[model samples]
Target: MRDWFVASRVSAGFIVVLVGYTSSAVIVFQAAAAAGASEQQISSWLWALGVGMGLSSIGLSWYSKKPILTAWSTPGAALLVTSLQGLSINEAIGAFLFSSLLITLSGLSGFIDKLIRWIPQSLASAMLAGVLLQFSLQLFSALESQLILVVAMIACYLIGRHIAPRYVMLLTLLVGCGVAYQLGLLDLSSVSFQLAKPEWVSPDFSWQALIGVGLPLFVVTMASQNMPGIAALHGNGYRPAISPIIAWTGVTGLVLAPFGGFAFNLSAITASICMGKEADSDPSKRYLASIWAGIFYIAIGLLGATVVSLFAAFPQELVTAVAGLALLSTIANSLAGALADAEGREAAICTFLLTASSVSFFGIGSAFWGLSLGMLVHYFTQAVSKKKQLMKT
Candidate 1:
């Protein structure tokens, strides 16, 4: 293990993973707060999520001997932010438990896995492209807000990629920090060190919350988040066992639900960070990177408040630019895969555009709608092609 860590460049990989994961921490907190959670509840949420992600990443990656990472559901977090208005905290906890239970059942029954199997590779790729397009565009779009920071990061990324592709993410992050500090954008005064303590809450079941919030959250997290996450892993040339990962996430979520782990599942964006070449040259050794990530996650869970404060010290724009740049490769790969098949080109285009638009309908986010419409179009096109082939025959 020590040799694996040394060969995989564990320190560099850890820093890269840290920057990639911590960049989104603030937004996660904001989303949790917007979900009607109290400050303590939000703190608990972080604790649960951090611990769940940490343990799952450690156990699964160790067991599978691959870089399998787990993360809180970003879409599910956003869903809670908008949908939990006027909802009780107990009810939200209930919804979380219910969702976790449902996910657990899905993993056990193999229904979800079977459903994913039926989805054409083209459509899955398209859905992934749809999900990630906005994030990719943010690389350039963020320049409008913080030109110097974004430009510096982008330039550093390009230069680093040319010189040392493995350390591009690390170098870009350093550049972002330097640029942000030079511009007086970072506020280090707020930084402090402390340990995070988990606060437990009792779960209360509510039918209203279950139907309105839990079911939708579960569906979106599993479909929009986990589905794309698994696709990303497979797309990236690593095929970790899916059932055990999902089941483990469910188990973690169940254990931490009362403590405020809203939703735990496979990660897409941050996982990509750890699974990429930056983590290791030999793919087999990449599990060490995940093990390192798990350690950081546990540290964050133990020092949740301090971790949040430290991350908050950095300028928002700097983090945004770094995140946007770090994800460029994954986004490009997803786009290429999505449009690879001529038969699904139009449908894929539709999916990409709709998701990038960030439109919302009936309180559900655009990712779901984009996938739905793209699938509809893909099926229709496939039917038409079948008919034409029959005629020719």
Candidate 2:
């Protein structure tokens, strides 16, 4: 037990939790607000999401003996922020339930993995790169506004990368906070110490929300989030049964939707932290890192309101810069994978460009369109090549 609970593993796990909260918790808050949730309901949203993630991460990691981490779908939250217009909280709950049900059905039918397999690796990586490209741009945008804070964080990240790559996010966070403090950017007055309490609301189903929010939510979570998460697990030499894991997340989301859990899915970016060599030299011990991460998630859920306030205290620029810097390595790795295949280069570039464009058609996001179009291009090119070869013969 002591061997598994070593300091480095604990720290790595803690860093994953920290980055998860800091990077996208605000988007969750905004989504709740857009749904017209009361402050109490927002707190409940945090509590539900935190608890759901905690249980899923710990339970799955223990059962599989792998670093199986779960996260609230950040892209889903962003979608909710935009798509919840004219929708009540109850209607949103209905959408969440609908999306979860679809996900569960897909897994049970064994269709989800088959669909994912149909997607070329380059396209999947391209979609991930496109989804994350906005954050990369925001890093520089924040620099333009808060030069010192961003510059300090970048310097710390570079130094940490050179000396101790495992803790680059932690080091950047510490240095960013220090710089924010010195520059009078830290504001703790809004911070408080209060535990979050869950509030339940009965769901009111609407066909509009079901078609608009539910369908898109499921698509983005599956195409943009879960696909990359599986890739991360595979890329890192870990393979667990994908269907059951996804089905379990869907079930958990279904149970918690009424309490403000919007979407639940496997984590790609943060899971990489716990699954990587920095977590442990021995692959077998990495599950312990996920276990520690689960423990921290429970604490965050219990203190959801307080954690929200604490994150709120940090300046926007600080948070933006930190999130961007934390994801820099992930973005680079994804870009490399997206462009890795010589044969798929044209299709992959098409996916990346369309996704990064952030264009929406018929209420669906670009990530979905990018993959769809890329696949079409792939097949079309292949057909043309084959026909030309046959003509030569």
Candidate 3:
């Protein structure tokens, strides 16, 4: 275990947790606020999420021999920001329990795996591509605000790619920090290390909360979060069985939800960082990165608000640039896969466009819409062509 604890992999793991927290930890905070959670309760939320994600990610990656990363449901957090309103914290906990139960059943029944197995690789790749398009684009968008910082990061990535491809992300991260410090962009003076204590809210089950919050959270977490997450793993050529992974996250959520772990699912975007070549040149060794990520996550949970302040101190552009750089190869590979299949070309393109739009309806996200539409279009076009062939015959 200690043999593989190299700096490059450790950095990769840190980047994964860093990206995950920076990207959606704020949303989690807002969701807690929506539920009218007090200060201590909010800290509990962070503790639950961090600990839950860490345990599942490490367990799955080690057992499965895949760089499997788990995350709090960002979409579910977004939904809670609105739907958690007017519901007591106890009811919200009940809703979290109910939703996690649904996810567990879905995984145990093998439905999620079968459904994912049914998706065409082309469309799956398209969905993954669409999901990452924004992050890749954000890299350059950061340039407008911090031209030198972003440029230095980009240059570091380019140079590192040529000479030391495996360490590009780490080197880029260092350069981004250096540039940011030179510009006085970081503010860490207010950061403090305070361990978070978990407080379990006894659940108050209500049909109203179940139907309103529980059900919708289940739907988005599955369709938007889990689906894309599986797609990401598949895109990157890591095919860990989907059912057990989902089951693990659902089970973890069930255990920790009362302490404010709303939902946990397979992570797509941040997981990609751990699975990338930047984590390690050898794919099999990448699991070490995820294990390292799990360690970081556990530290965050244990330290709770203490670490969040540290994470928040970094400039937004630095985060954006690193995330974007880390994911470039993944985006490119997914695009290649999406376009590789001539038979599914039209469907793949449609899926890509729809998912990249980031549209949502009825609390479901664009990934679901794109996947559903892509599958429909792919099958419809095939049927039409077959009918035409029959007519000719």
Candidate 4:
């Protein structure tokens, strides 16, 4: 029993990584409202996304024997928050279906897979590093508002890294909670236990929603999040079938979209956590960790508010600090890979800077634009270099 519990706990680490990547509750609420969903409808949305992600993770990870994760699109969530300002709930669902269908088609048609092949590895790595750098900076910035909480978390993370590197995030969370309790920063009295129930909103498709919200959400999620996620998998020495995974996520999202599942895609940062040696010494055994994560996610989905409230009770700074520290290794590796190749240096640097800048143009985030520009520069430079060499010859 003791050994079994230990195994279970290790499995739970996958869910921890997922939660650490982006607390679902915080983002889901904002995402639902942005899509003009009501309170009840938003709860349903959580149910949809949670179940979708959980099931996809389980099935894909099991079949491929790799750590395949499915997550609600962070980029899509962000897009909805900005674009769903005045849209009706039905229209938003319409947008959801539209984008999902397009995603499915893209996966089936092999266009996205082809596109992924064309990108330089350095540029992809640079884009990933840039996207994550913002979160790392924010971890520190959060300290200004909650110094004691952040400091406690940082101290715990350092100590934990030395003692039990595999469970560093878990240890930091535990120690941070203890400090928060001692400092009287924690409020447990408000915590409540409640299951989340799915509430279905009738589908209403609108051209406006399709063009304005659906298309952009699809584009950004694929470009900014999924692309780098796949790149991370390849970078880390796991190459699974891309089209099937993409197709599966789209199908899951489509089935659950009416219930509040927005966009589901591959996870880069959290997946890496489970994929690493810390999870297990053997790469073949890592899938079990992801399977365990899926189980925990399913439980959270069923428990709903109870689980969300528990995480919400933690001081924000604690979450930020721990997340930042946990990702330090990954960030360093990504940066190293991005700058390693001499030929790709200029283009990779452009990608990194542009993504790090966080600029937005025409409602699109910098991640996509940065990668686009980088690829362009890389291709152009290669062409010119080849031309010059031929002339000299």
Best by lDDT: 3
Task: Output the better candidate (1/3) by lDDT.
Answer: 3
Tens digits of per-residue lDDT for model 2, 316-385: 8887776677567656777788888888899989988998898977555677788888899888989999
Best-to-worst ranking by TM-score? 3, 4, 1, 2
Q: Rate the local accuracy (lDDT) of all candidates.
A: 0.75, 0.84, 0.92, 0.76
- Return the lDDT, model 1, position 346: 93
* Per-residue alpha-carbon lDDT of candidate 4 for residues 1-393, written as tens digits (9 for 90 to 100): 343244423644543544543454676688777766766676677678767878888899889988887777876787788888888888888888888888888888887778878988888888878877876797889889888888878887678667776676666667777888988877777789877799877778878888999999888878767887786676666778798789888888788888877788888767766666556657777777777777777777777667677777776676667666656666777889989999999999999999889898876678889889999999999999999999999
Query: Measured by TM-score, how close is model 2 to the native structure?
Result: 0.85
Off by over 4 Å in 3: none
Enumerate residue pairs that collide in model 4: 45-259, 45-260
Q: For every model shown, what is its TM-score relative to the native structure?
A: 0.89, 0.85, 0.98, 0.90
Off by over 4 Å in 2: 1-27, 30-36, 78-92, 204-216, 231-239, 269-289
The residue-by-residue lDDT of candidate 1 on 1-393, one tens digit each, is 456546234544455446645666766677667666677777777778778888888888888887788888877777787888887778888899999988888888777667666566666666666666666677788889899889888888888877887667767777888888889988879888766667777777889899999999888878767877776677676776577678778878888998888888887767776666766667787777777888878888877778778777877677667666766776777778888888788988887788667787765566667777888898899899999999999
Candidate 3, residues 326-357, lDDT tens digits: the string is 99999898999999978889999999999999
**Looking at model 4, which ten-residue stretch has the lowest summed lDDT?**
3-12
- Per-candidate clashes come to 2, 0, 0, 2
What is the lDDT for 305 in model 1? 77
**Using lDDT as the measure, what is the rank order of every candidate, best first?**
3, 2, 4, 1
| Alpha-carbon runs more than 4 Å astray in model 1 | 1-41, 85-87
